[model samples]
Target: MRYLIYICFLISFTINSQESIDAALINSTDIKIDQIVALDNFETFYYLQDNILYKQNKDGTSINYSNYQLGEMSTANAFNSLKINLFYQDFNLVIILDNRLAEIFKIDFNTAQPYKNVSYVSTGFDNTLWVFNIDFQQLELYDYKTNKTRFSAIPVQSIVLSLESDYNYCWLLTENYLYQYNYFGSMISKIENTGFTQISKSNGHLILKKEDTLYFKHKKKEDILPINLPKLLINQFLLTNETLYIYDLEKLHKYQLKIN
Candidate 1:
């Protein structure tokens, strides 16, 4: 009789946990996606397919931008409605595009001084770029117009895993720690790492991934919310506002998150 009671309790606990997880996921939408990006304000989304970049609006209308000379786009960062920076890592070049996907300018890092190799790049304030100079192992604020380094931080010890930034601040994620810095290249905060494969940012919230599970936390808060996903291979994912986007090889899944 005691063994029977224990089995029943285990089943009840399992069902309750599943129910709790279901309550946090409100809705899900699936669509074919190759690469996905969300804007800073969480008001727009962009996806890339077959070397074509598409800007998706709330009404489902999309605008596309393509360049044959740029080759394949490696990464894109939309700093605001006016400026979007795209990088081609293989060619060591960066292109600035307008909201309509029109090209503004292109910079070749080989010609740009003080940087022989850049492992990562992100948009920064006043039409500048936050670049990780792999040769120096330092973070630098590079101005494209003047072709100069505005500010640079001291060399870091570990290799960078990922980087995220907005107009005012930049966040660097290494294997052992996460570092936050202001526009002046001053360290603001440092958080210890615990095995995250990828990281995404929106407002003050951070979404971290490890294996198939995701964890969300506010920069000012201590509590972390764990989100378990269905058994699907995730090629990439992004979080903006309260919405989460998970991408497989051929499809993208959008989910609304209920966070307390």
Candidate 2:
């Protein structure tokens, strides 16, 4: 694991640089959302409202799913568009949804053998899930079919803030640190979070956001570059592929993330 430190321009929590990257405004859409939920690669918007999960597509079509019995949806992972994982942390339950928003299956952690008190979950490779078992203080590659743990990472005593994973890697973000682990349960890199509040992966790169500035971390690069962005009210934001979506609760602004 390596730590790379760069000259971070911290002037009142905003990156001030003449050679800053440009975020070209592409389009704007008016949507009523508390926060920016997620905008998929296909330009589909996924939003959770009043216990119902809505999928609004670009073709003027939408679908929704809801289960009041499970309580509110804690999070929705649309990493795998074909199979979406909707987790309800309150009841430790997960509902898998198909592309058409149809319920495929449900995973109840309460009745699960071995009894894992999972606090976080995300889509994983080949019918598996990246589950953060709070009881064990570790992240596990869990296979729901066999109800077995494929691989478990080392325990972290700190509170896990966010978890993002691809097929080969799982990234765990804590209060002051961000860790990357491989499928073999090996820790790859441990980078200080440096005031970051959220984690989003797009095109094999990480787009880290703080208060008003956004940082970029390419997969092959060790340095974290601050994305030069204009000051705007960002209640929530999503960096998907070449586009960046910023929502101020009432409208969604789409921009192209052009890195210098």
Candidate 3:
């Protein structure tokens, strides 16, 4: 499929509001985590500490998986819950795990037929994955089952800070702009970046973190609203189901997102 390039200038970008939403201190769990990955459900979540992946449940039972030979576990995505994705960027490897944290499939991009230099990866629909090919500097919706690239988007011109995608859309955040694409390889929109270091997507809304501050953007609105967070050290965070989860290496904090 051919990629449609849609250029967005700074003049077209505007913030919807300067107001900040409040983030209540729902509760802070005393835990050890290097980074927060994803929420499997209300009672279960996954995290990485000391390069080992852990799935912690509210009942105190937890499961973990580790592979030290892969260098470091760059990121873990629990988007599908059952089919968890573990990306080892240094090795160009992606491992799919079962709900019980059992190894199921391994995709080594370095040795794959076409040889993809993948710098980032996230879960996608129907045995597919959102892969950022560093070789071409382009984003692709890759089908892992058939070992084929279904569609590829335009090349990103700047350094990609983060990559977030759901089933239908993918958002690529670069140094200069935040680009959004659909399932058909079409450029949906591009927003000028103020200074977001990380991003989390859920229900068509974005929870963006610039340094230690957080902001929210709606799917149908242009307003980028600031989210007022309590004074807590934030090392990594994830947003799921209108709930915000933060991990500061020592404790995990939970907050309910109240949006107007």
- Model 2: residues with Cα > 4 Å off, grouped in runs: 1-20
Candidate 1 on 44-73: residue-level lDDT in tens? 778788888889887778898887786888
By lDDT, the best candidate is 3
As for TM-score, the candidate ahead, 1 or 2, is 2
lDDT of 1 at 91: 88
- Encode model 3's per-residue lDDT on 141-238: one tens digit a residue: 99888999999888889998999888888899999999988877688899999998888898789988887788888788777888887777878778
Would you list the rank order by TM-score, best first? 3, 2, 1
Error of 3 at 74 (Å): 1.1
Q: How far is candidate 2 from the true structure (C-alpha RMSD, Å)?
A: 6.7
lDDT of each: 0.79, 0.81, 0.85
Strongest candidate by TM-score = 3
User: What local lDDT score does residue 54 receive in model 3, on the 0 to 100 scale?
Assistant: 90
Q: Which 10-residue window of candidate 1 scores lowest in summed lDDT?
A: 15-24
In order of appearance, the predictions have TM-scores of: 0.83, 0.87, 0.89
- What is the model-wide C-alpha lDDT for candidate 1? 0.79
